[model samples]
Target: MRFGMALPGPNVAAVDCLPLDVLPLILEHLTDRRDLHTCAQLSKAFHNAATPLLYRTLDVRVTMYTGMQRAIVLHPSTTILQRPEYAKYVRHVRENGAVGFHRPDLMDDCRKALKMCVNLEGFTWSDDSAEGTDEGDFMRYLDILQTLPLRELVIQTFYGLSDSVWAKLQDFSGLTKVSIWCMEGKPRILQGWSEKLGASLTHLELGVSSLSRAPHPLYFLSHLPRLRALRLKGAPSAAILEILTFLPQLETLDTEYFGAALTRYDDVPAANLRHLTVRTSSVHIQGFQQLWPWIRRLTPRPSLESFTLNAFSTQGEALVPRSFILDMAATHKDTLKRFKADSTQMTLKDIECMCTVFPNLESLSCTTMWSPESAPYEEAVQKANKLRELRLNLHDWRPTHVRLAGLNNANIEVAVRNMMLREGAALRLVGIGSIVYRGQWIYKKAEDGSDKVEFEITSNVIKDVWD
Candidate 1:
């Protein structure tokens, strides 16, 4: 009970005698910041253990609801200036430019605080305010950040960045990860910034963030040879595959697929891509017709482990063609572990193909037109022995409602129980008709020295970590 003096009863909390080095390691498991903050006030040892965890990452974003508040809330940037000792503990800072744009005192405090954060490794500056940002105000913070050991930078501006801002970014050659999201500008390649940061850049995300006229992603992404993850929005679907040819080391890609015809990049070679996600919207089936061909082109890339398709539209059906699933099974059946096409429709046959073909699938999510009369989902349940999670958007009810009109909570529970009781079932989570269920496999020793397993399933409104 050497370190048990902080708690109410020292004799009862004997485990506090854990070595000083082990105390912080144990505190790392606590996810809630409020709990860490409370622990920091308990004892000096707890303060020493929790203070670094508290200041390690400072996020100062003004929430939508904050605009309605009358009182002025003190910004965290001012706290760092008041207590300079905590500044060295800061490793990452994400600030909304709107948080201090109108308040000069807070902006000055942030500028002073940035200089003290010598160990800061990452900085994210975003302004979602409708008003434009002054070049002078933005540069002051950037100049201070340039002196820090920053390796990751994210700039998301609703008002497009000016040429001067782009020019200043060229000096950040040491950065390894950069994400720029411009909601109002015509997306173009920052060739100068790409060339300047290419050697060290391992992750890059650029987005024009609209439905049409997305520039080809290859123009901006081709220069970074060391990239491991790249996310590009509003890019043509046809040219996405071409990027793998130029950057052999790239592994993860998240891009907007505009359903453009595959006129080029037909000879894309085998790539070591591990994850692929494409988002698109179309008003007709022809859009998906073009989508399948683009997917089929990935047949050469057998190393793919995860594929996600996010489809959006005002009208018309979103269906993942059977041929697309077959093409996926043909090349990536064994390696693919998580397949999420939640926005699209998948028939029972399509679900069967996914379950049976990809024996290693750990998570599967899709939209299904489920009816009480339709055949039971036994084919998928029996074959998906390795499946850990399944999420379905049952199209039997109106999409605007919270739950399916046809299926009640009782019906969902029965459906979930049936699936969990299947032989050799590894399924642990299921979401159907916008309702989620968590499954627990209860095991006990049988009278004959064998194992007996039982299923306990419950509706869980709160999502699990993996969900």
Candidate 2:
């Protein structure tokens, strides 16, 4: 049924007079599944538009009924051969638990759904319940997925990436993003995959086991074309830096630290990079130092806008070097907008220095880092004049050192915003567009001696969780 030229049925003709935009506006408010179903049946036009919304995400729940899962997929698989209309509506498919292969009818249902849903973009089988249930039926999943056009695919419980499995991946020529957990296949599987799909891949996440014992840890990343994002947790800093050298086009990078050897590498500034987040397994001085190479490699005046360094010290006392902020300012002073360094013991003077380093910073969150010192209160306030969203959770046990005491109590924040406004800062409209002043000092210290703090909760654009 070509909807573009099909004759409008009586059911659809009713809403045809509504403005083209009205349908979407009306549907946007109809978040309930039952309402969408009712709309789909009320009019053919609604049916055509609403059907996709109704079936956009199909999560196949493996059940024990054993009464034909295919019937559950298409509702009417027999009519599916005659009517291939349901295929276009589906975009994402989620599979969980035992999709029993013992039933041929169920297998046929899976086959039919995959075959018809040609426009499918994502397919995932990441059910924790599907563990130890690979009962030699891995190929059946590959067979089903090979027939669809997939952009993102996740495999949680798999026996291995055998030759057959690799061949199945070859079928999804458009596959750009993948996450494999139960990796039973060859160690060389990912390298081969990167070669085939690296050119088009934009996002890649690896959740494999035994990464430290692997022969070539960076083999998969070597062949990949410079993509938009890469996430490989628990990988050594050396291997991560080496792979990053190959991907200069990356915009977002998320990696972890696990006591990897940090060696200096030739700098290839990632000019396009915008966001960088690093998480450490355990806080070590070397872990903090390992971050230098990533920032140092950034091109002078880099495009970085957001940086999050979450280093958890074992003894609850991690320290961020002053040079880290200097390096950031050198590379992304003008472009840097958001900065978060967790559990680091930096003084208020350090934060004040950061405000100067990142002049354009709109958000700053370093709760655990800025502690024990509020000596630079006046200077810090002046430097942080431009910040719109701030989360400073430092050691403020006494009223003398209360969190945001001076600014939170008196109308000092309002005075600062007023000053900023007077200095040619545009008035920000809340919930309407860009930065708008909703309220300053969202939270307040409840005057509890147990190191506890309080904050105001507003359902608005900016939120500063202080303690």
Q: How many residue pairs clash in each candidate?
A: 0, 7
Instruction: List candidate 1 stretches off by more than 4 Å.
Output: 1-8, 11-13, 19-30, 42-46, 61-73, 185-188, 209-217, 373-375, 398-406, 409-412, 441-455, 461-467
For residues 1-467, what per-residue lDDT tens digits would candidate 1 score against the true structure? 22323466563255346567987897877888887887787766678888999999988745445566433434677789889999999999987776565465677777788889999999988887556456777788788888889999988888667777777877777799988887775454665678787789999888774224544446656678899998877666666777777788888888777766545666674457888888888877666677777765654757888889888766755778777787788888889999998778888778988898898999998888765623566556678988989887766544434334444456557767778777788888887664588988688888998999966677745422122
Which 10 consecutive residues of model 2 have the lowest summed lDDT? 426-435
lDDT of each: 0.75, 0.60
Taking all chains together, each candidate's TM-score versus the true structure is 0.86, 0.68
Residue pairs with clashing backbones, model 2: 161-185, 344-369, 428-436, 442-456, 443-455, 443-456, 444-454
Off by over 4 Å in 2: 1-51, 60-84, 98-108, 129-137, 158-167, 183-189, 260-264, 267-272, 283-287, 298-301, 342-349, 368-388, 392-467
Worst 10 residues of 1 by lDDT: 458-467
